[model samples]
Target: MKTYETLVAEALTVVPEILPWDLQSRLEQAPAPLLLDVREPEEYAAMHIPGSLHAPRGILEAAAQWGFEETLPELVRARDSEVVVICRSGRRSALAGRTLVEMGFKQVQSLKMGVRGWNDDGGALEDADGNEVDPELADEYFRARVRPEQMGP
Candidate 1:
């Protein structure tokens, strides 16, 4: 049986991942990739990469398509644009990137290490209001909180 880890691994195989620095460089280029943050709203409100568009994973498919109430016109139009899917630690983004690929997106990639990695790499992060988030505080937010029940049996 495939576990969550296996699913993320499988998704990475089909969805290329971009390192934080590389992604930053790409963003500086003429045509920047659309940064899609798939994390929940609360998580995003706390901190996120600047310019990232929020599209929670729960309704990602609907948000990506046209004619749905949840439809994000930017996402729908980005089907032919370079898209970078992001999440807390990269796992969710990889899964979302795979979905974008299947949804006929021309170019889809996951952010390697996600917002956590970016913060670790000295990248700037912003709150939903566009205020700069303190790196140290962001570190605290991104810290792994594995539960006992989630550990190896």
Candidate 2:
């Protein structure tokens, strides 16, 4: 079996990594690529990129098969759509990007540094209700939950 490092290296070769600022700029452009969050439901609920679609890494491959009541986004169901996968710290989403590439997705990328980078770069996150998450609360959560070791230099 391939090691995590091996897998991530392979994914990095094929899937381009986009910084938070780059993604923010892209979103401002017309026809923005789909932002797909591969974090768990609770993580997504706590905070996520505005306009991102949630498909937890565990169920990402089968997301299309899930019922609409489960909140499966239509963009994930479409095979040919351009997608950027994101997780808490970019590791899971790198694997998810590899999965999408293996599944024959033509255009797939992983967000560099994940939501942490986005938050650090002053990007806004939305709550479950689609309201903008308070910056202080977001910072508190990040500091409390994210270890310094987790944030790679």
Candidate 3:
């Protein structure tokens, strides 16, 4: 078995490093991180980090063929690129980031605190393809999907 750091180091050639606020700043400033959201489809639909790409955790599990296969060209292309992942919290992205690194992606990082953290810090929301969503409907969409009881205990 590999140590946690060892596992993390395995795939990452040049690991990405940016907390939620820093990431938000990166998005606003010069170069932006390719924000990857690894949540479920429903979760992503309800809310997600602005400019984030959705490549759910299950898909990420098959990192090798996810991008290379013509059937999933967009996802595959993303796999080959640098990305920073976000989930509800940060654990899943950390694991996924390591997996992405292992799959030969040069850079991957987990956003600290995920989408929840981003929203807390006043980051904007966007659709899966990185387009702005209707602000009026955004809260309704989120409330319908991500209720307190819906979250796991």
Candidate 4:
């Protein structure tokens, strides 16, 4: 079986692009790209980049197909729409980015380091209610909840 690093590395190779935290901040301005957070709902609620749309990795394809409330069907319909996929760390987003590209999204990209990287780079994050999420608190939560194996190599 492939290790997580191997899988992520392979996915990254084929993904169209990667948006670093600094670049993502710039994109958050006018004509913002679609920021899709692929973490679970609970994780997203705990903290996420403001304005990001939530669609867990598992249901991403289905959500796109059936048109859920948060589904960006219009954006997805436009093959070249700038869509950025993100997860708790970069691994899952890389895979998700590959999936989007395979699904015909020409401008799909993954957040280079996910939310953790964003926080490390001083990017702002918010809870589901739009309130700012304290960085330290968020870090503590992640440390407590994330298993070492999940972090990969």
TM-score of each: 0.97, 0.83, 0.66, 0.83
Per-residue CA lDDT of candidate 1, range 1-153, in tens? 999999999999999999999998899997898999999999999998999889999999999999999999999999999999999989999999999999999899999999999999999999988999999999999988999998988
Tell me the tens digit of each residue's lDDT in model 2 across 1-153. Answer: 998888888879888899999998988887788888999899999999988888887777777444554446575455687789999878888889888888777788899989988998999999999899877788777774667999789
User: Compared with the true structure, what per-residue lDDT tens digits does model 4 show for residues 1-153?
Assistant: 998789899898887445565555657587677888999999999899887888888888865654566565754564577788888877899998888888877777788868887887778899988999999987876664667899779
Off by more than 4 A, model 3: 1-17, 63-75, 78-81, 127-153
Clash pairs, candidate 1, are: none
Which candidate's lDDT is highest? 1
User: lDDT score of model 2?
Assistant: 0.84
lDDT agreement with native, every candidate: 0.94, 0.84, 0.68, 0.79
Off by over 4 Å in 1: none
Ranking by lDDT: 1, 2, 4, 3
lDDT of 3 by residue, 34-111 (tens): 777889998897778766667788877554364333234444566556578888766667778777776777667888
Q: Could you tell me the lDDT of residue 116 within candidate 2?
A: 84
Lowest summed lDDT across 10 adjacent residues in model 3 is found at 63-72
Backbone clashes counted, model 1:
0
